[model samples]
Target: MIARARLIGVVGFLIAGATGLISSTQTWLLVSLSDGAAEPLAVAGASAVVLLAPLSLTALALGAALSIVGRILRPVFGVIGAVLGIALAILTAPIAIQAPVSAVSAEVAAVTGIRGESAIAELVAGITATTWPAITLVAAVLMAAAGIWVLATARLWPEGGRRYQSERAERRRSGGPLDAIDSWDDLSRGGDPTT
Candidate 1:
């Protein structure tokens, strides 16, 4: 049951990470100009001000990898990842609720290349909507849930054989050429190795 849970968590983390990464490139806000045309602005997930998308994605990836290895430190990493995810969600929610005026204004000015007191600038200041940020928030929540699951089930997870095995022991066991042979064979007809 623990193994199953861990597997589910790993899959969730991976999916969340991928979703966050993809959404980061999408437009977060739409700025409407004076001409009644909507201009897609910067992505919330990739915004420098938020800085949550990449961080959350990276944490989810690390958590998934650690969970797969079944190491003793998996729980620690998982908790850290979870906390990061939660932080991402918390930070992004407000941004999605209302677009930052200063940032949007600067972006609009840069994009439309219209100076102050211009009709376009006024339109840009008044036009802002939350779209992509909501998606990022959802991804962050998923990642956080996955990390928490991993943390809870990591101790019950099965240890990987390679993780505990020593390199010297493996080398010593395969010291001879016959170690590579699966079974001995005779050149006699109608001979059965098992018999």
Candidate 2:
């Protein structure tokens, strides 16, 4: 159960991050111009929330880091992941709730050369949200849950792998003949395997 918790947390974080990245590439909103002179402009999740890509990338990195970090750092990364999840939710919630015209204002301006919030609002007849925003929201929730899982189970996790073991432990394993790779590893740890 202990190891399962660790694996579950890591997998959850990774899946959530990947989901977020995928959603960012997808269209979050379709904006129909009031003039009806042009097709609705599609606004990608990244455009809806400028930080979406960066935050998703951060979550991916945090997930990778959590897999190998020592017990002491596990909770730290957990907290960071939770905070990131919350921030992501905050950024997307407004768009999900309101589907505000400003969400696609920049795209509108790019297409029609019109600027200013009020002007763009006038140009936008309606904003229709795609499923991507909801997917992102689910990802955010998963990320936070994974973070909390890590924090709760961090203490129960086993110590890190061989590389994280103590120098004394490595030095003691010198009974067998050392291969080239093993000799190099020992040398790097400031120990001569020849003894």
Per-model RMSD to reference: 8.0, 3.4
**Over 4 Å off, model 2:** 162-195
**Cα lDDT of model 2 by residue, 1-195, tens digit:** 886888888888899899999888999999988886767789999888988989888899998988889878999988988988988988888888889887888888988999999999988888999888888988998998988889899899877565545544564575646567667887899998687
Q: After superposition, how far is residue 165 of candidate 2 from its true place, in Å?
A: 5.9
Error of 1 at 113 (Å): 6.7
lDDT of 2 at 164: 46
RMSD of 2: 3.4
Clashing pairs in 2: none
Instruction: Kindly give the stretch of ten consecutive residues in candidate 1 with the minimal lDDT sum.
Output: 178-187
For each candidate, give its TM-score against the true structure.
Answer: 0.67, 0.83
What TM-score would candidate 2 get against the native?
A: 0.83
Candidate 1 C-alpha error for residue 181, in Å = 9.0
